[model samples]
Target: MTLMTFVYLIAGLILLVAGAEVLVRGAAKLAAQFGIPPLIIGLTVVAFGTSAPETAVSVQAALDGKGDLAIGNVVGSNIANVLFILGLTALIAPLIVSRQLIRLDVPIMIGASLLTMGLAWDGSLSKLDGAVLFGGILTYTAFLIVSSRKDKAAAEDDEFTKELGLDETPKPYGWVINAALVLGGLVLLVAGSNFLVEGAVNLARALGLSELVIGLTVVAIGTSLPELATSVMAAIRGERDIAVGNIVGSNIFNLLCVLGLASLVSPLPIQIAANALAFDFPVMIAVAVACLPIFFSGFRINRWEGLLFVVYYVAYTVYLVLFSTGKPVAEVFAAAMLGYVLPLTAVTLVVVAGRAWHKHGFTGDELKR
Candidate 1:
């Protein structure tokens, strides 16, 4: 890669972070002004705002005929949101699970993950599939708005309230300034995505790496920085719900909104490397499914769980690098993860779930998750 490419990549990442922050602040302020519930705003507006980078990158890649990269970004981002972002945030502070997440949002997330797997199994997500996924987001957002209004009369939750970004000591800004922030953020996101994708694709070609690999490793992580920042800050501030919710919400949006829009731009054919099909895509689904057990275990993600998450993510990334480079150790890494780590994790989750069941004694959480 050229020095200029590195500069472009760094600049793109900086723009993504700054743009997401500005967009979120402006959108959250607008939501608060209109008296929207914190949970709804966090789940819908802030969630989509933070996910804007992924949306831009994926759609841009798709338009540029790099559908594999676009699809990889969606899948990889979802996995990272769960195992990397949420895990790290929980380590910062044990994320307090809202019963609502267990009862409602997580199930939706799992369903979405499963749907993605099914749709992509045919080696593509067509425009019809995109339409269906995009439609689901619209319906889900509407449902959230209607239900959340009834639940939270005036933005009650402390965590989501803080996500509103505008303090109680509100100094009113004119509508034009807020709108300008939103528009400028969008422009930056688009420009940043163009630069990032260009740098990544060029670097991939120069290094003899496939577009899918670049998308999964570099582009995916780069776009996910917003989620990382939001969740880390939320955890630090004890905005526990938003910390967890941001990740979950972003995962949903990555699949439904980001991929949906990208696929509509072009048929996002899953013409990817075999490793992605065999390992990464399935791993993404597995991670999504894993959330149900972990969250329900004690209705919280503990430090140990977070540590395991980080370890698994590290192992995944390392395996990808080794496998892509045709290293001898790649087989061993895959075996260890598939033969030992996965089985042990499953057994442990069963134990924890059973223990939780006995302790909590079969509330509706089981039925819901």
Candidate 2:
């Protein structure tokens, strides 16, 4: 590839990061000014702002008729958000799983993912399918907002207070300044996504790789950098709720908002690649379902669990590279993972979840801290 190609990728990444940072900061402040709970802000405003790059890039790719790139971007991003970003954040500090996430948001996320799979079963996403997905996001957001009102006790949590600076005095004209920042961030995201998509398509052609592979591996990770940064920083600051919530929220947003909008804007239905339907979609769904047992195990992600996540992410990425390059070892690796690692992990998680349930004597209404 030419030097200019690499330049585009690097420049695009820098802009995406800068844009997401600005957008999240402004949006969080704006939400706080309205007296929104910090967890709600993390799940909605911060999540949507950090996800702007995926929205921009996927929509741009759809308009260009590169449907695979668009689809791969959303799927890959969801995968990375959980496996890479959340894993890394937990490694930094074991994350506390908010009960709201387990009882509400995580289940919503799983449902959204299953809905995407069902919609894509026809191999194309029509405008009607887009409507269904987009509608889900609106409903989910409204539910979170309404439900948050009953959970004012969450506002008293140390992490929420520290994260949102709930006691700090608001500056005059804060809303106006925050609005400007949001707009400026949007402009940068649009520009950056354009560059990133163009560079990715060209690089795919040069390397004899499919646009889908490039989108899944390189572009997916690149676009998800914002979520990575937000989660890692939150974890470092001990804002455990925001750290975990951001990843889960962004995954839901990616599927519902990014993919739905892209499908709607496409002149024709976006095609779902056969491999993606058979493999990637199932993998994404498995990852989402896996969260239940892990999070239920004492309502926190331990460092050991975090390391497991990181290892799985690494193995997943390596498999993608090998498979894309037609390496014989790819099959062996897949077989090993399916035959041994996955089953072992599943059994281990079941035991952990059961032990936690028994130890806490959890009823339908209560979970011990």
The TM-scores of all predictions, comma-separated, are: 0.90, 0.90
Candidate 2 lDDT by residue in tens digits, 243-290 = 888899899999999999998999999999998998899989999999
lDDT of 2: 0.86
What is residue 82's positional error in candidate 2, in angstroms? 1.2
Clashing pairs in model 1, backbone N/Cα/C closer than 3 A:
none
Query: What lDDT would each prediction earn against the true structure?
Result: 0.81, 0.86
Off by over 4 Å in 1: 28-43, 157-162, 165-173, 267-274, 362-369
The true-versus-predicted C-alpha distance at residue 329 of model 2, in Å, is 1.9
Model 1 has an lDDT value of 0.81
Among the numbered candidates, top lDDT falls to 2
1-369: candidate 1 lDDT, tens digit per residue: 689889878988888878887888777777767776567767677768888889988988888888768877888888888888888998999987777787789889989988877877776778888888898788888887777778764645565676475566555675567778888888888888888988888888888877887888888999999889878998998878778877887888888888888878774453445566777788988898898889878788899999889988888888877877889999998888789879999999989977886877547554332
Give the number of the best model, judged by TM-score: 1
